[model samples]
Target: MSIDQDLSHVQSLLDPSEVIPPTSPLYGPNAQGWAVQKDLHPRLVAVPTSPESLARLIAHLYKSHLHFGIRGQGFLSASAKDVLVSMTAFDEFHFDPHAEVATVGAGQTWGAVYRKLKEAAPSYAIVGARTPAISVGGTVVTGGLSWLSAEYGCISDPENMLDAQVVKSDGSVVWASTEPDLLWTMRGGGGGFGVATKFLFRVRPYPQAIWAGPILLPRQQLPTVATRLEAFLASNPDPRVSMFLYIIRKNLLETIGAFQDMLVVHAYDANGEEHGREAFKWALDIPGAVDQTGVTDMEGVTKLQQNVDKSKGTMRQYWAPLFLKTLSAATITRAIELVDELAKQDSAVSDCTYLIFELFALCDAKGSCAWPRPPGAKHVILIGAGCPANASAGQEEMARNLAEDASERILGSRTVNLLANGGEEFHDPVMIWGENLDRLRQLKKVYDPNGRFQGPIRA
Candidate 1:
């Protein structure tokens, strides 16, 4: 029960490989993550290979009061603390075609899950990260967005989530999903509820050749193309197609040009290539444009997200989002010009993407998640930027400022997500969570009375 006992009990229950000491050379390897959340020391780190190991580790940390952090695929990183547990060893994938769902491990990445799911059922898929490195746990907890989002809604299953095996904050193992409030919070509440070892997500069937890929448009035709994109999704347009507009410095948009040049990074996902091309012919009509459109399997969906790979090893990044009601022509033009302006100012800012998440499925469902948005709001926009590690403080600050200004314009004292606080630009959690903050705080009291989970919320 004491901290100085060396946690011999935790080591005894699992294989020797599961326990990683802080003094060992592998310490840093186990402590590292995709995003460097903060600076903290991890006195003890363990990679649990099974749910039982995780549960036992939790019990030890609880008795010692050494709040732990769950590092899954290093997607959501933070400074290691008293204890750090890597779910990487929990990577398990099992898909039941008859049940039409996938029992995926939290440690598994979208890429790995996709590969296995395709082998088991290529005709079926689930909402997941667009990159292989993003863990299924992070994506599902944070309202995962995917190419098939228009049809399937958020990648996490709140309504259809079968069950989740988790180690509650009190160091007891429990299966969630049947608990309405707790399940809703875990569905999209961004962790902090409990340490989930595995999740059951309802798989969706494609039943056809999926046509999807990026289609670059002429930089000069930003206005023209933006208008068409807005109109394409204005009505009850087919939910089969999803769009993501990235307006970045023309230099990054293409392989060549001045650092300040800008372009519209447009992409499409559809049941078929012709359907995708036909859906946005107005954009194709533009002259002197580059087309890199191609069809790939379901696994290829997350693979196309090249930014994650490019940002590896020391790249500094920031993400700020806003859920907008509509994408009018004027709104689109202003957004593009804003990106150009921001890129011109901060050369370190590689690109700023306008991420649009289909919210049609969110219409009939309100108050279903802790992350709140206005009614009739069917799209979520995020202006994210990545810079070299050596980028000046001013450069990162400028990027944060640009995104915050745009978000406040529509969100109005309400922020979709908090801005980067380490480098000075900080947005209050109240802005991001608003009224939900109180609810989560109360929920934390019920689930994690001691706030031992420490995933996102402080309460």
Candidate 2:
């Protein structure tokens, strides 16, 4: 644990400028993750500019048996106490029109990628993360659930993720598909096998403008909204339509001097305005509702999504994904009750918390994913609880408990997502990869035998 000795060794191998010690002002921010609770301190941070440099650093760390974590856009918590490798320098994006594919660097954010696509490839779309700020590489390898997932499946599915370039523990760079096992494990099996430098994504046709926007209604209308949502799910809506229902208190609703709860519905229709409006006509017609629904292109849709997801920045946040067999009336009612309980238990926590219900139509594109998609389930409920950055440990624990309790009540079995960091230790690979757990572990041993890489699933 000689910090100076390790820093000197690392600096000798790579450029001195690439190595950042804790003494540096940049180290403070670089060490912290998106969530304040994951404010871990790494002994040193490495910022490699090229894949060859990354390979060299990873190889050295592996040979020395030093554990390091890869940081991409700081979306997930890093397991770095020794060395942290920041992928920001790898920001590269190239789209090929003839091949209809995109070569996206691991460091690129969905927001940057979306903007580029809008300018050069507006007629094409890649299955990408809904939130604009989330990193591309982290989302894909960890099982990306995108707005277009209903149509094209996960972004990491074999169909969408055509190929990937990874740097193995031995410092040898190779296409993941060359090692069939590595490719399968990387496809939604979760990270830790190796450092995925970049990926080739097959783009789909984005021919028409989509109808999307948010509508805010009084929380008292939960029952009525729930009934309609239940029917909407049961009615087998078009695959082109995806909707998110959120129960949020007004304190976080960007409204001043208002603490009342509000039900926010964000509806999207990929089929255009006419059909999109008709499908969600019931919700639009609700009285005393503040509706902002309209037709917009992909850029507008992405901007709307970014605006709605105000969960980023320096804050203590916890979110858990609860998959339901059916969005029945009873289930909806119980969910509402859980949200209410959370609010009543702690007023301070309630003001900063919100619950989300993702209602998607029947999609057949999840068959090729490594992460097991819950069978017979179309709705995934996520409860997000947060506290202030400077909150005490007890306050953070209270917020986490509120979110986890609600998630457990609705969950029939455990589901894992790197983003669903609700104070749960995901050391069990079975919970994440499910049936592919054994195979993924075998590949981990083969590729990362010394366990130099750190991720949710431990080898």
Candidate 3:
């Protein structure tokens, strides 16, 4: 059947308000998340308001052999040339303090979850996305990385992901755990099995107060900062303390025009202000630094990080993330040189691009998940570049090439949370699924034999 026939057939099976055709103004906003996703050109969007409706739609698409892509927050890449299943209508939020689990709807944003949890359960926090705008479903299934991960591990870890409510391809809605194999794959297996409607995440006890913020230093101090960071990681500091080192145009966040570079040291100590101050003393003592560090609640901290990490979605963005065992001096120096090279080009890419090195101190405890922290892995470095939305294909390719090249030179493994798109780039299935490749393949066969879902790990 033609794309139009598929869309028309699906449209008749749903409520009028739920079917958004390409001609609708809402189509543009609903179809895209980041600028890079703007061209997916889904013929129509289906917004199912309930699990029954979602299941009904999935079943029709599956049986009819119609191609579709599920979209939650739109951060991840998706193509629905035929139909785009928008999970936005599934927004629901509930917190069971006694059970220590937050039941988040697939469409809910992390920001809303954090704010609500703060009031509903003041002393606890869920292992959620660092950026408030991110959706829970996308972040969790894609291997969630959080500021709290140092203590709790990935949000999708088996221990934290108490259960997931999924609608299988055949239109059956059930708890993922009901099928042990289904649950295992959903726990950070990188989403392809089914559509998750709700998630039950175990929450952790958090103090009412904590210290976290940014410390900006001169760009030339990259060497000193790198040396201190390497030593700090090797010293085996408390797991509660985490840091992110990155270089950005001084004007990237503030002001406009002539751009000067600066190194930002963002530290987070979950243990209240007193212990946090002492824990990050080395960073605090650095001279000529602009310190924005202070004591705040979890919600406050998330908002602060979001303020800087959040993007307008107006520019085309490409990301390359590397998982390294350690931060080496040579790696840091090379990163700075690349930054300099981009600056010299004096192009649009330079004005908005930046490199971030995230330091994750894995909790001693282990978790069963797709990409558990490798024995020695400690850093997840991300090279992100952006370009004008109207730029030519060459300009867009330039942005992607820059990100991919930087990550290759940095030397680290690819992570599903950031790189598994089932696309032209990063095509090695083994790199994404690793040792679990065989097991996941078997599970996919049993759960989705027809390959009704589009997954990155497929052969």
Tell me the tens digit of each residue's lDDT in model 2 across 213-239.
Answer: 888877777778878877888877777
Tens digits of per-residue lDDT, candidate 1, 213-273, equal: 6566667777677667677667556777666666444546447443444344455555678
Total clashing residue pairs per candidate?
A: 3, 0, 0
Off by over 4 Å in 2: 23-25, 252-259, 307-313, 365-367, 411-423, 426-429
Model 1, total clashes: 3
Candidate scoring better on TM-score of 1 and 2: 2
Q: Please report the TM-score between candidate 2 and the true structure.
A: 0.91
Q: Clashes in model 1: which pairs?
A: 130-302, 250-261, 250-262
At residue 193, candidate 3 shows an lDDT of 88
Better of 1 and 3 by TM-score: 3
Question: What would the C-alpha RMSD of candidate 1 be, to one decimal place?
Answer: 3.8
Candidate 1: where are CA atoms >4 Å away? 1-14, 21-29, 37-41, 248-265, 350-367, 409-436
Q: Model 3: which ten-residue window has the lowest total lDDT?
A: 415-424
| Model 2: residue 457 alpha-carbon error in angstroms | 1.8
Off by over 4 Å in 3: 35-38, 253-259, 307-312, 412-424
What TM-score does candidate 3 get on C-alpha atoms? 0.92
In order, the Cα lDDT scores of the candidates are 0.64, 0.74, 0.75
